[model samples]
Target chain A: MNYLLDAFAWIADPAHQAGPNGIWARLGEHLGYSVVGVLLACLVAVPAGLWVGHTGRGRGLAVGLASAARALPTLGLVTLLGLLLGIGLVGPMIAFVALALPSILAGTYAGVEAADRVAVDGARAAGMTEWQVLTRVELPLGMPLLIGGIRSAFLQVVATATLAAYVGAGGLGRFLFLGLRTQDYPQMLAASLLVVGLALVADIAFGLLQRFATPAGLRTTR
Target chain B: MRWIGDNLDVIGGHLVSHLLLAVPPIVASFLLALPVGWLAGRVRWLRAPLLSAAGLLYAIPSLPLFVVLPLVIGTGVRDATNIIVALTLYGLALMVPATADALRSVDPRVVDAADALGYGGVRRFLTVELPVAGPTLLAGLRVVAVSTISLVTVGAVLGVPSLGMLFTDGFQRNIMPSILAGIVLTIALALVVDALLVALGRLVLPWTRPAAAAVVAPTQAEVAP
Candidate 1:
């Protein structure tokens, strides 16, 4: 359509690519927020999920918490936090981390829990300590699903980090918001394309990562 | 509590709008996804593309979708129609794959038995395959319902009337009580809906519940090992 072509023209324009407001710079800010937020969520969630999976306690609690967390509206959370924290990067970052946590936690827990019980018993019977079994046996076997969780989390953070714009933290969302206000349809379309494109690229890259990270023995012939 | 009491009528109105916006999309998507899912399940080659498309749709963030939907669909920026359309897409994204997987999971033996009993393709699918796959289908529906209910709140960002309006109003006024009320109400709504779906699933598929409990007993012992 002509509109898509116009949007492509906007993307191709040198003027839009060179300034502080350039797409590249906005992308960097967006990635910066997303990377930091996902890392923070992983730091907190992965370990907690692994512990719960390893101990086989609090599975219900973890699931309950994750589900409840998933149901919280992200925009509302970001804006509410912004109101309390004065609309800085902090509020959006908190929202991003919160958004990513549930997926990662649920994925990790499900992956570890779903590991073959026979293999886990074998490791323990081989005189391996609990920690050693977890590190050596369970972790590698569960790597695929753990990566799957991370992949979903990463994509979610990248997608949702656009809300950073709402709090005055610059990201790809700035284009869409500004375009909306100015009634610039092409610009809005272009920004959406970028977000969709970024999400697809991340998803494909993670899909590949999951394949590589999966142990050869565990790989099923689909 | 006091703030909610004072704004009871406003909250009530928005809640009705929220349900109106969410429920139709869910029902519509389920109906639309049924045939698509059957096709995906029946045709091996179509499975990858169909599921990948759903995944791609799911990866799109709600905010961008909200902002750009008007351009894609020719709706007004602030129209409730935009929210309905976006939410319908989301429901389809989730339910399509779920339906495909559920149908694929139907016991082939049962289908064969139905065929042996002189049931036609459509009749077998409706009576046997669907009933056999009921639990998984219901589980997927429960997830979609809860997610749709939560996501309806995001439409508040564009000022479509929903419980999300409470969030916006509370934020603009810097009223924590109002914001908390919105958050609590949304979560409570999700929980209640989720519980209702679970009960509905049990009522509709009484056979699956006993089988589910039987499977759980062994899993508990496996947990210790």
Candidate 2:
């Protein structure tokens, strides 16, 4: 308890808040990397997943890829990339993007696949083009799952982004590694708390986003 | 390849430690989750809280958990016990919900039939509900097995002497072969374990063998990270 209080006190201290190594700067770096990583993942995964789901040609392959990707250890990947690329933000970013990809891709593919077949048939019967049916109908209906995927991806990236510190990049994990090195248990606890706190906040915010972005009918049916 | 051949004994030792660190937690958590999951499935009030707790546990990042396990468990920083206990907690977090869902997925008609045939609650659960739920339970186990295998490497960061040591040592020495070897071995271990579990599931639940492909499709979605 005292350790926790001391950790909180350390975080509250203005000096820790204002310096180059302060919480704000580190938090910014963490968020920046996570956002970029997730965006890159989304850019690649969503389109690929959507195409695969729409075409129904590679669903099995997509799922297999996601599973294999998920099984790769993030820490190992980060270090491996760091070794190859010579330790910088790029290594961790690449790792984070890889980590984020599977969930989003799975979600997009599953969501689209789970869309109402009847509605899709109806859209086609009404003479909408394949692309039109996908973009306007399937994507809209699949929004909930897509958002779910994004939410999972966001949480994963943020949590795993702490590994940035391990690869000589700056993030909340600095406090964790630094605390471990210096035997500053309080700092370690504080950083862990920050990571957990950030994850929870992102989860809640995305939950709301999922609720809002999902169509009214779909929400009630689900 | 030469480096791997040379370090075969060392890598084998690490693999043993990794299995030691991983397998017990998975087995223990599965055993523990059985009763909790049964309770959650049977009792409406317990389900939400139980699943919520599991979700919270699952959400915790692995690195922080590994670092903090010693403080939480009163173990030495370098103790493998810390990793074991931490992984057990994680295993429980994953398995609890899976167990609950598996039990819930059992067809209610079979339960009703068992009850109608005058079997008591315990007998019905053991003979009917459990057998019916076995396939889904096995599916859940497959996810847990793969997940636990992957996560065991994370403990290497804290010096728990798993194959992850390869990563740490490789990074320190800038040795790509060792790092690649570790990654390959770790992933291969996961795949092998997953395959074994799938085969075991087939052997135990012959009725489910035909639908094994269908059963595995949704298992990927349940993978939380």
Candidate 3:
């Protein structure tokens, strides 16, 4: 189809591959924002999740909050915050962090909760302190789930990072919104293809991480 | 508040239009996924491939799908049908897996018990597996409902009218109230619809215990913008 060919040709264009507005830069910006946002989310959510999971309290609140959080619209949050936070990266990053937080938090506590109770008991019974039990028994046992949540967060942040262009931030969304406004279907298709490629790569990489990261005995389920 | 008061009609219209774009996909995908999900659950060889396909579909970020679907379907880029169809695909992504899981969770012995009592495959599925799977299926439907309603807002980026119109319109005009109203209304719509779903679930499948329904199943990553 000409549509598909034009999109392929558009990406193949040497001229389109460079400049501040180029595909490579947009991809970099997108990855940069996603990585930073996800890291920020993990830092905040992981500790809190561990606390709740290890202590077994506040689960009711966490579940309610995460579900409510899931209902909030990503674009609505981005636009609202982007305007209020004075455009650029400030607003979108904040919103992205917020959006990514719930899943990571849910994943963390859920993973920790899913830890083998017998192993935890054994760790405690064998003269390990509470902190030692948490670190030695639960954390590694729960790595797959925590990583699952982290990847979910990573994917979410990447999606929001794409929408960053709407707020004067730079990313692959630049191509997307630009093409949308200009009716450049090939350019739009090109951006879509590039994003799909990134998603597949990330998915496979994380799939590998989630698999090998799991302690072999624990890898049977989940 | 005065802005809301002044634009009540417009807000109401957008709300109506938003429901139009959001509801059918939930219904269509729920109905469409049942057979696909049932088959995927029933067949040994199909589950992995079917679910992986769903994962691939869900992995495609929503905006890209919105743009690409028109190309595949020959709809205009801005067509409402594009939003409807996109939302349905997303619903199927979440529903198919949930549906399969739900069906798989049904106790095989209970199904056998039903079979011993003169229930045929169709009758047994209706009498046993579907009822057992009801709560999880409903949980999945609720997830679909919430995410689909929220995702519809993204369509406004391409100039469709919905509550998201308020966000875009508000942002362009630097009107905080409009954006806030949009966000609140969209969330409100989700909650209200979710409540309706809970009621509907109870009405249609009264056998599912409230205790089991208390645990809201974790929704799989819908992979949205």
Best by TM-score: 3
State candidate 1's DockQ. 0.48
Error of 3 at A79 (Å): 0.7
On lDDT, the candidate that comes out on top is: 3
lDDT of 3 at B185: 98
- Candidate 2, residues A109-207, lDDT tens digits: the string is 888887899999999999999999899888988888999888888877876787668779888999988987787888887887888777777777887
Error of 1 at B35 (Å): 1.1
Residues A90-127, candidate 1: write the lDDT tens digits: 88888888888988898888888878999999999999
RMSD (Å) of each candidate, 1 decimal: 4.8, 6.2, 6.9
lDDT of 2 by residue, B63-170 (tens): 777666666677765688877777778788878888898889888888888888999988988888888889888877777878888888877766789988998888
Model 2: residues with Cα > 4 Å off, grouped in runs: B211-225
| Ranking of all predicted structures according to lDDT, beginning with the best and ending with the worst | 3, 1, 2
Model 2 reaches what TM-score against the true structure?
Answer: 0.93
Candidate 1 lDDT by residue in tens digits, B157-221:
66788988888888878787878878888888888888888888888888778888898889999
For candidate 3, give the lDDT of residue A126.
99
Least well predicted 10-residue stretch by lDDT in candidate 3 chain A: A158-167
Q: What are the lDDT scores of the predictions, listed in order?
A: 0.84, 0.84, 0.88
